[model samples]
Target: MKNEGMERLGKDELSAKDSYYINVMRGLSILRVVLVHLGLSWFYPPYSQYIGIFLPVLFFVSGAVSYYSFLRAQSVGEYLVKRLVLVLVPFYVFAALVLLITVVFYPERFPSGIGVVSWLLVWPNFSDVFFPLNQVWFINCLVVMILISGPIFFITKKRPWLLWGVIIFSLVVSLLNVPFPLYAAVSEYSFFSRLRWGHQAWQVLVLLGLFICGSVHYRYLAGQSAKKYALISIVFLIFALMGYFYSDLGFELKEHAKQRSLYYLFLSFFAIYFLLALERPILRILARMRSLEWLLLYTNRYAYSVYLSHTLVLFYVEQWLGLTDLGGQPFLALVRMFLVLVITLAVAKPLGDLSRTLAHTVRAKLLNGIIGGVRT
Candidate 1:
């Protein structure tokens, strides 16, 4: 019995070390989002749906990561401050830089009063204010999710039945195929969401569900063997396939995944499970290729910045490429992909670094100081 107990603890230690895999997922998700924005979802139908689980993967991963943060923080205030800085610091810096560039380089396109003020707040669909930053919709959602997450975590720990009820309501919203959109906001082109402000009040189940799935995984599923994860993945895959054809629970049109359904949750769960099942093999490969590992780490380091700024890079690249027939011109599509990735990294990395620096300063000078003052 003692030996078995020791083995379980050892497995958990290894799992904690392998937490870096979360970054690998983030790096891949951002790249997939870039591809989605570049018209891959429109032109390439085959694998897009598979990779389009990117958004779900991100939310789940965020939930899991936030669980770790939730465990460590000394108080709720520290936790929120950390969360806010983690997202908003780099974003505000990026917005300021973008606004400056527009003013100097594209004065006619310079934002006016509301557009100027909009930069201070993050919203799901800000395309009218500035088209390039449309992708920050993801950021907007994350901010709200983080704000509400503390209490949710408390319920999960203290009131399982209450949490389960919330989960049921969320799933009911998902299964009902509600026309209220969450992520896409009230945009006209969304899957079916026609109602206003659904993003705020109604979660469409998939969004909140992924976060819960992630939180649960952090608590109960973190240290499983690859085979265990693979088995779990198989179960989710069967459910996804079954749910897809029967209930239209997966993708809205099986083309663009702007709208998610209960089916997509199963699909995303499968994808994350499969990723976890790759634990041993991926580590082996990364061990042999230090450079590749470094690249993955680097990609993740600025992934948030990339998510916030990549569409901006895509817009410029498309303009430079003459907005040509990319579907017909394979090479141009490749060029578009390359230029977007390269230019995006060049522009985004600095903002990412600066954001972290600012956040760190804020933590030390503001957050920590406030906590200390209160204690003193």
Candidate 2:
């Protein structure tokens, strides 16, 4: 009954249709996270190069979803604190634990993991340090972007042109390489670097585009037709495939720009279209087997926890299988990926469930106290 809060939010706060899309998007995002990591070895040459295109799109979708939630929230402080507990707290805790493991338990990998100091302090680059939590850079970026966009969002609530103006300005700055004061000048840090992009100003430009797109979809779009959406998705998929194999774009740039922006656009459209096309049949099937619904609900609820813990499972698997000693071969690599995926799911399931339960309990307590005045 307590979980009915979602249904209530659907009926009262947001349109039922909109809430459903948000849930579907969340589920798809988690699935893509698994696929991107799991199938990394299996990806063909060009696809391999552009393998991580879905990541930024995840953040953009997060921006959209969180923006809606922020509108429903009580205050910015309350919203941010809640998100910190849900996202950042777990990330840092897991990061620390993994760092401790690598440093204290297996000292050899400590150097490898700790080598990510530049990523932590300077600007973002691919570092595998405390990978489970550290890999959540996308989510961290989303939270930061939302915080920065708050004022702009509030001011441009009904003024569409102003939001558009901000987005265009940021993009132009990126193209022109104008050194905006938007970047942080924390040169005193121990890991400062001269990286031009992924700095504050550069990130602001990327985040601004995502924010504007999310707002546009939220306010004006009425969702898409299924067939039309599928066509659009297929086109994007073709582009992704082409970009991976034929395009001359570097992996990093493709991951950040082409892959993310295009994937987000296509996938969002596809999901909306697919669900609309299947709504009646899907609802009927779910109604026929209510248990299936609970299974899905439970998996989705703990998806973030699973994502945050899966990498440790992979690292341990590598150690257990003596993967470090073996030279990489196609067959052996495939075997390793399979073994790691299985182990990761096995370990992530229970841990993820426990995390979800604890999160739910805390949320329930907070909601109770909010609905009922605090006691002495």
Q: Best by TM-score, which number?
A: 1
Residue-level error in angstroms, candidate 1, position 66: 1.0
lDDT per residue as tens, model 1, 308-364:
788887877777668656788888887888888788878877888888898888777
- As a TM-score, model 2 comes out at 0.64
Residue-by-residue lDDT tens digits, candidate 2, 1-376: 2344334433314567656555544555565676566556245755563434444445545656665656666655444545544654444444555667768866655644335553343222444443444455555556567676666656765564476676566445433332332233332233434443334434555446645555555444434454554565576556544533443335444443432333333333344344445545665776788775554454456666556666666667676776643334657767876776566556656666555566556656765665465332
Q: What lDDT score belongs to each candidate, Candidate 1 first?
A: 0.69, 0.52
Which candidate leads the pack in lDDT? 1
lDDT, residue 132, candidate 1: 56
